[model samples]
Target: MNISGIDLAIIAAYFIAVAVIGVVVARRTRSGDDLFLAGRRLTWGAIGLSLFASNISSSTLVGLTGDAYRVGLAPSAYEWMAGLLLIVGAFTFFPFFLRSRISTIPEFLEKRFDARLRRYFSAITIFLAVVVDTAAGLYAGSLVAQVFIPDLNLSVFIVTLAIVGGLYTAAGGLAAVVYTDVLQAIILIAGTSAIAILTFGQFDFSWSAATQALPDGHLSIVRPADDPVLPWPGLLIGVPILGFYYWIMNQYIVQRVLGARNITEARRGAILAGLLKLTPLFIMMLPGAFAVSLLPGLDSPDKVFPTLIQEFLPVGLTGIVLAGLLSAILSSVDSALNSASTLLVLDFIEPLRGEKLTPRQGRRYGTLATLGFMLVAAVWAPLIQHFPGLFSYIQAMFAYIVSPVVGIFLVGFFWARGNAQGAFLALVSGHGVAALIFALVQSDIIELHFLYVSGLLFALSAVLCVLCSQRFGDAPTDAQTRDLTFSQRDLTPEETPAAWYADPRFQAAAVVALTLLTVIVFR
Candidate 1:
C-alpha cells in the first residue's frame, strides 16, 4: 500500500477545501438554529444531497464493499429495501413532522405523550449518536487514515478526525455539514465509480465469469427462507420495520429532513434520497463481488476497497479515491456531532433545568456537547476493530434502540386510544425485552439475529400500548380528530414548489440513464 505523492497531494487539497468551506459557513451562521438546522431554510436540492451524503458513510463505502467481497451482493438488501421504505416515509411520516413544525423528534414525543418519554428518548438518542454512531464513523475514518499513512499512529488518526469534524460541526453546525455533504457526495460517487470502472476493466468487464465464479448464494437476489442475512421471511416484516425507523424516526437521519424549507421540499428530498440509494448495488456491492475475483482470500474483508485502490488505480487517482473515503467518513461524523448536540441542548438540558436559554446560550452549550461527544467517540472507535462485520454491527445496534421507538411513534400518531402512559410504559418494556434478548443471545441462552428479536419486541410494544390505552380510559374526542388532521395534510403541495415534482424531465432522464446502465452491465 505505497501511496504516491500525487495521491497525498490530492487528498490534502480536498480536506483543505472542506475545512475552508466550514469556516466560511461558520461566518454566516447567525444563531443556534442556523447552525443546527440550517435556519430551517434548506431547499430540496440541499436536503436531498445532504441526506444521501450523511447516510453513505465510510462504513458503507468500505464496509459494504467488504461485505460484498466476502458474502456477495446479499448485503445490498439494506440499500435496495430502503427505496420502498422511503416512499412510505415521504407519504406517511413526513406529513406529521412537518405539520407539527417541531425542532427535534423527541419534542413530538413530548407533545404526543409525556415529558418523561421525551427525556428517555432524548437521553438514549444522544448516547447512541455520540457513543455508538459517532464511534463507528471515527473508527472507519481512522482505518482509512491508517491505510493511507501506515507510519501514523492510531491515536493521531483519531485525534485528526475528531478535531476536523468537531471544529466544523461546532462552528457551523448543520448548515456547514449539509453544504460540505453535497460536495462530499459528489466526490464519493465519482471516486467509487472510478474504482468500480477500473476494477471491472481488470476482469475484462465480464459479469458472466464474475457471477459464475462466485458461490451459489452470491448471485441470488432472494436468500433462503431460513438464511441468516436476508432470511426471506424477514424481508416481508423485518426490513420495513428497520427502514421506517431509520429513514423516518431516527434522529441522526431524520434531522436532515427536519431542516428542510417546507414539507414539499422534505418529501422531494426523501424520495430523491431513496432513488440515490439504489446505486449502492453497482457502486459498493458490485465492487466487492468483483474484488472476490481480483483479490481472493484476503485476510480482512474490510480491506477490499483499499486493496483495489492500491492495485488498479494510478497514483493521482489513488489520492482522489482516498479523498472520497475521507469525505464519506467526515460527512457522517459531522452530521452525528451536530445532531447529538442538538438533541442534548434542546431535549435534555433545557427541559431538565427549566431554563429558556437564548440561541447564543444554546450554541455555546451545543459546542461543548459536540466536543464532549467527539472525545467519547474517539475512545470507542478502537473497539469496533474487534467486530466480525461492520454492516451487521451497525444494524444490530440500531435494531435494539430504534425498533421500540418506532413502535411508540406509530401508535401515538395513528391510534387515538394510545395514551401517554401506555406510550411510556411500552417504550420502557420494549427496551427491556430487547436488552434481555441481546444478553441471552450473547450468553448462548438463545440464538437469533437481533433483528428478529427487535421486530417481535416492536410488535409486542405496539399491541400492548393500544390494548392498555383502550382499557384504561375513554379515547379523548379531540385526540382522534387532531391526529387525523395532522397526519392527512397534503404534504407534497405544502412542502414543495409546484415545479419541483411536476417537472418530469429530470426523473425521466434519470430513469432512462439507469435503464441503460442496467442493461449494459447485466446484459
Candidate 2:
C-alpha cells in the first residue's frame, strides 16, 4: 500500500492540471447560459464523455465492486440496464428536450402539465440529488481517499473534495464540468481497464481459475424472485424502471445532454454513453466477482476496490487508478452541485422574481448556491455510515424517492388524456406508496424485494395518474400538446434509421444484443 515518490508526483500533477482547467474555464464564464448550459455549444463527444464520467462516480466504482464482492454480478444489471434506458431517452425524451429549448428537466413538465407540478418535480429532484447522490459520492470518495493515505481525515477529504470541485463548478459551471469530465472518463477507463487486466493475469487469464471456489450465485445476473440481493424479477421490472428514471428523467445526468448543441449531438452522446456503460461489467464488477478466489474473508464487501488496488497494480499505476476513482467522485459531486443550483435558479428562483436578474447577477447567485449546497452535501456525506453499505444505501434511497417521479413523467408524457391533477396526484401518492413499502421492508412487515416494491409503486403511481386524469379533467387541446408528445416527427424515415449507427432503433438493438450476450455468458 506504500505509494512511491513518483506515484505521489503523478497524483499531484493530476490535481494541479485539474486546477488549471478550472481557472481557465472560470475566466470565460460570465452569463447564466454559459454557466448552466455551457453556452449551448457542447458537441456530442464532450456530452457523451461527461455523461459517462459523471455517472461512474466514486460510489459506483467502490460500490459496484463491493456489491460484486458481497453478492455477485447482480449489481452490474444497473450498469447494463442503464444503456438500454439511455437509448429510450434518446428517442423519447431527447427530441422533446431540445425542441422545448429548456434548461432543466422539470421545465418540460411545466409545458406539458403546469407550474405547480414543475415546482414539485424540481424540489424532489434537487433534494434527492443533493442529499442522496451528492452526499454518497462525497462519502464514497472520502473512504477511498483514506485507503490511499491513512493520515487523511474523512472530514478533511470531504471538505477538500467539495471545495475543489465546487470552485470549478461554481465558476466554470457546466462547461468546466463537461470538459473536466472528459479527462476523468479517460483516466477511469484506462486505469480501471489496466486493473482488470492485471487481476485476470492472477488466474493466468483463465475465467475458470478466477472464478474458482466462488460462492453460489457469485457470477449470476439472474436470481430467484425472492432473492434478497437482486431477484430475477427485479431485472425484468425494477431495474428498467429505475434505469429509465436515471437516464431519461434525472437532472444531473441529463444536464450533459441538455447542453448538447442539437438533437443529433444529444442522440450521439447518449449512444456513446450507452456503449461505455457496458465497460463496468468487465473492468470493475467482474474483478470483484472473481476476486473471491484470491482475496477472501474480507470483513466488508465495500473494501473490495481498495483491497484490489492494494493487492495488485504497481505503485505509479495504483496512484493513477486511485486518481481515476477520485475523478469519478469529483465528476459526480460537481454535476450534482451544478444541477442542484440549476434547479434552484431556473425552476425555483427565476420564476419567483418580478424582474429577471441580469445574466451576471444570475451567475453570481448560482455560484453562491453551489457553494451552499456543496457545504450541505460535504457535511451530510458521512451520515451514510449509518446505512448497511454504500451501494445498499444508494439503491434503497433511489427506490423510495426516484421511482415515483419516474411514474409521473411516464404517464404525463405518453398519455395525452392525462390531466395535471392526475400527474400531481401521481407524484404525491406514488411517493407515499414507495415510502410505505420502504417502511414495511425495514420493519420486516413485508418480505417483498426492494426492487419489486419499486416496480409496484411505479405502477400504482401510473394508475393513479390515469384514473385521476379521467376524473379531474379533460384532455389538453392539440395546440397545447404540440412538440411535447410523440409526433410523426419522431418516426420519420430520416430519423428512423438515422444512419443505422446513430438511430435509436439500432442503438436499442445493440443494447438488447449486448444484454442477452451478457446473461448467456455470465449467468
Model 1 residue 106 distance off true place after TM-score fit, in angstroms = 0.7
Among all windows of ten consecutive residues in candidate 1, which has the lowest summed lDDT? 503-512
Poorest lDDT segment (10 consecutive residues) of candidate 2: 490-499
Off by over 4 Å in 2: 491-508
- Those runs of model 1 whose alpha carbons end farther than 4 Å from true positions after fitting are 386-389, 477-486, 495-523
lDDT of each: 0.79, 0.86
Largest lDDT belongs to which candidate?
A: 2
Per-residue alpha-carbon lDDT of candidate 2 for residues 1-523, written as tens digits (9 for 90 to 100): 5788887887888888788888998899989988999999899789889999999998889888888888889878999888878877777788678878999999999999999888998998898788888999999888877877799889888888889899999999999999999999999999999889999999999877887689887888888877887888888999998888788888999988888888878887887898899899999998888778778899877788988988988878987898798799899989999999999999988899856778998898899999999999988998888888776677788888878778878787777888788888778998877777778888988778778878988888888998988888778888787777776565432344536675656666787688678878877
348 Cα displacement, candidate 2 (Å) = 0.7
User: Any residue pairs clashing in model 2, and if so which?
Assistant: none
RMSD of 2: 1.9
Score every model by TM-score: 0.93, 0.96
